[model samples]
Target chain A: MPIYGVALLAGCTLVGLFVGDLIGAAMGLEANVGGVGIAMLLLLALTNLPGRDVGPASPSGAGVQFWSLMYIPIIVAMAAKQNVAAAVSGGAMAITAGTLAVLAGFALVPLLSHLARGGGQRGERRDD
Target chain B: MIDVARFADANGLLVAFVFVGLVMLVSAVLARQVGRGRVHASAIAIALGLVLAWAAGVDTGGKNGVADYPLLAGVGVLGGAMFRDFAIVATAFGARVTDLRAAGLAGALSILIGVVLSFAAGAAVAIGFGVTDPAEIATIGAGAATYIVGPVTGASLGVSSSIISLSIAAGLVKAVLVMVATPLIARRIGLDNPASAMVYGGLMGTTSGVTGGLAATDPKLVPYGAMTSTFYTGLGCLMAPSVLYLVVKALV
Candidate 1:
């Protein structure tokens, strides 16, 4: 069931958060560092175990799959949690930074695609 | 009659879930009927959420937006850091190793390049805006990587809440723009194939935006794009608050 997935995710999250805190402490920082990222790595590793039937097709995997796609709601919730008026009134910097960053990212897409084309073509041939 | 207000207060999280569901339902309809599928429903939902939060802030004169209302008090917890992190981590479950292999080295490089370039652009803008603190700058730059990364980095760095909010706003803008722009420029960018799609996903780094944009461009490419994009967020989360923060500190 999806609950099992949630259980697995919860375990990963706790372990991840603990490790993140340890890392932060080691770095002389006061916060949990990369806890969510660590949890994701754990989940990815667990779900992709070799010769395991725990892939998305399995029951627990179904739970994992369901929550994985449910990120939209979570994202929306996160957005809603923000104080937009405060952020906007604070300065033009946020918008400016965001827009420029996106533009920069967009500009690089073509270059990366071109660079990847040769390698991607070889991979495609091997797969075929 | 039932004491509805008290009941809502008691079930705030449930109410918040129901309320967000309604908003999403409406957003999906709007995306189809008004946006004509060019825009992703999640983008519209985010926009709507921001507007509602703004309205709630103005109406109640409170900091937590709609959560200030007793009936929606659960929004505070529902949208809290705990659930946010849980959701983000769970997204990794959808990624497949085979998909990553198909995209090759370019796919991996694109993610690193995308994260660094986006972070640098954001940090530069923050510096231009006269932000002197490295932590704040790194947090904002991480937000440029993705919304999830921004807050995670901010919380890790112990930056102010307002700064974290700004970071999220920055990421949101990127996601919306990416969703709207992908189809319009797909052909010109040669995003017709799965390999290119994966690279595009790595570059964009917003799973929802990449998936939505690719779905509009070609449904067959969504899986490929989403896989790398998922990795993008993970990489951003891992790097932003640690290595990137130190780098910003050194420079500043």
Candidate 2:
């Protein structure tokens, strides 16, 4: 059971975007797919800490089960004003956003590996 | 015999909860097998649940909104499981993979391709719809986001950010930050970088409020980080409108 898996997802995704936007603006760039792609990779790395030994293969569903149940309320709210058709219509972009985000993520895994190599050449500095 | 539409309209959330609970219960019952049977059953159960919900006239395609509650609950649970799996994969990789230098180059190219795809898709949609005002569309998106996440977005991103642009921009930047910040944070928190990056990236992607990976990666910081990040993102989502507005003003 990861202590902070769901607990941190909401805030980081939203704020990460804001920060990303600010950075993008600074660079005179708005978000294209690539920018969003990097952000997805960033998200994958950010969640690693609180997520230790808390997967199905590990044989414990207590932690995630609780959070998953808690999401009922949020989902209730999500469906409170719409239905499947509505979600697909109103949320088509969001769904698109989610799907695209994952694709961006897959592409990022390898790219980040390359970037890490460059960062290493600077020095044998292990912050960890 | 079952008039699902009527039931949902009257007790949508409760109805949804009951349905999801039943599905979980069924999955649990199926687990008394050869062990491996449970894993396959779990996935099958999830798919069945989605199918049942859709067929039972869940009304996710209607205007009442209350009908879709069941779907959300189910999806949420599944999403958590999938995310948990991704975390484990990252952890394993970090323990094994040492050469992060190469990962960064791959990161840039991948993100570039993703961004182009998003633009093409968005442009095609905009052109098809005959919608000329990008700002107006962004504003509408901000409002919709406000409805879902709430006023929390205001405090986090500001009151004038654009929803379309903000979401696209944030989603990607967080992706890049995964590589830049994960290792440093992993070290600070005493975890491996790859593990840190994968888990942290997922957290920030879903939550969107944590700063460095310190809160997410550290064992001791998990509880505090979880609480803080939860409150902030929920609050930020609520305030999304104000934040989006500010972003738009500042950027434009």
Candidate 3:
């Protein structure tokens, strides 16, 4: 990744994190607020600014894309490591949350599919 | 003299990386041998991670598992907020504003509806399990949205460590289920075309699961499905700590 793009991202992230900390402090939170989320929103807005015409295929754009693709899996791995550690040792509630979440997701599939089918048909009707 | 043991201790992250890489390699081999690609490498990796975490916890009696060891201290920094937050912020690149227009209203609505329903279902489960804390409930609910959402919600809400872990476990389970089930039920669920895959992804919301499942079902559908699933994480991240948490708080 180009240093500039990475640096730019880092700068944005720090500012966002600082602001998030401020927000968290204001809310009486003992931790950072939505720093990462705010940084993402700011990055997205800045990068995709209307009429800017920064080609998505450009090197800088590609650099951003490259890091972005790596984001979820990497973070998930790191976070999953911590979460796994916690769940394995903690009370039954942790396990319960995980189990129920999966069950809930499975249960929602049919209902969601049904809704999707109806919506798809409606769209088809509109197009026709 | 550069002592080898001291170097090893200093380069803890390197050790952690090696450890994780070995797990991935083993998981991949296991998936190939046992699951025959039916089970995703990621699912196996997560299972291995949990096992390792449990073992490390037992051995060290510490909160951070292997990171408690002098040689494995890098795991803590490697998995800390600096890296975690950076990875999260970088996800913004995946969201192309223009591509979203293709999904349009139906797709958009499905994403929102999917998020809400998942959150509600997860929250309901938390309540049933006697978890009355709004933060805990919301974190679990967000995990139902996606594993990524779970930690973000938990961290934002400042819930306990265990609750956050549960959220991740929930997301992982969902991912595994989505990976294994999507191909089997693809035709039955009308997951045949790009549009339908997009809808399915929106409704499911786990990027790894949606993408892996679509890859198994039909390689061509992976991109379409992944697109919406990416949006699902962003949406979940936004809603879980804010809207969904608020709703759960109000109810409880």
Candidate 4:
């Protein structure tokens, strides 16, 4: 994964953003519809293309891996908090939704786990 | 010493990156020193960010908090879709089709069930709060599915910013619960195997929550839970702004 490979990813991400913006416009929506999803699809396709493979354990592979891994934990963790804080002040509705959703999720678990069980000890344990 | 503030304003994004990096670093150190790894750094960082954003909001008298400052305007771009979406897309590289097959029908079922149930729960809450607009209801509902889903759905539907924010809040609440509760109740739920972990992840849908919770319970199960949770976010994104919104619109 040389600098060029990283550059290619940036290029693909921009292209994907453009395409997503276009889709959002076409649908008359304000959001980019699956821009990252489209970008990932493009990257996957581009990476596997002819002559694209530098070799086994290539630097490009490592580069893409590095960026991808970095993107997830840090960026997602940060943005989600920002978004939530901004919205929590919106009103009581959101607070209600947040609190209820958690409670509902908790209530759903036992029922879901039971339904998920196929049989045997796992299934039997639930009854007790 | 030409205006230091102006330089920060010009390089706001870079400055923001540095500040964010510092926050993450500090959170990690604190978590290590005091939390003994029980409190994840990511959680601590989020709390710190919230406090900073609140301080910035009060100082600047603006809506965007830290982003209201010219020197910190880059926070928006740093946390914007460009990077966020890149991260989401990047997750695909780690996944393999063969590995996904292990979950089979159970995993697949969990994703659908998780999305619908979460959506319904959120939507019900919104309606109880007297929300009439179908788009608003759906956006909040989608947020219940995942914070990522809420914004995507809200943006796609052109809902109000407040609604999108609420969605994110709902998702975050669910995430925190998942993180704290998963470990405490793993045994009672029989969440011991890879297949069960995948199902649990799907049912939860928040990747951070699923991964963190699973990590607290059994680190080996983290990958499996995260894989399905990732899929759950993608699925929620697809359904929330479209099929789910349409259904809600028709009903209301």
What candidate 2 gets wrong by more than 4 Å, as runs, is A1-69, A72-77, A87-95, A105-128, B1-16, B23-62, B65-204, B207-240, B249-252
The reply for model 4, stretches above 4 Å from the true place, is A2-31, A38-58, A72-92, A106-126, B33-36
Q: Pick the candidate with the highest lDDT.
A: 1
lDDT of each: 0.83, 0.35, 0.72, 0.72
RMSD of candidate 3 to the true fold?
3.8
Looking at chain B only, the TM-scores across the models are 0.94, 0.34, 0.94, 0.92
User: What docking class should model 1 receive?
Assistant: medium
The positional error of residue B16 in candidate 2, measured at the CA in angstroms, is 5.0
- By summed lDDT, the worst window of 10 consecutive residues in model 3 chain B runs over B63-72
The candidate that achieves the highest DockQ relative to the unseen native structure? 1
Candidate 4, residues B69-173: lDDT per residue as tens digits?
676777777766566666666665555444566667777788888888889889998888888999899998998898778877776787765566677667777
The TM-score values for the models, in the order shown, are 0.93, 0.36, 0.86, 0.84
Please rank every candidate by lDDT, starting with the best: 1, 3, 4, 2
Candidate 2 global CA lDDT score: 0.35
**Distance (Å) between predicted and true CA of B57, model 3?**
0.6
Residue B225 CA displacement from its true place in model 3, Å: 1.1
**By descending DockQ, how would the candidates be arranged?**
1, 3, 4, 2
DockQ (Cα-based) for each candidate? 0.63, 0.10, 0.40, 0.38
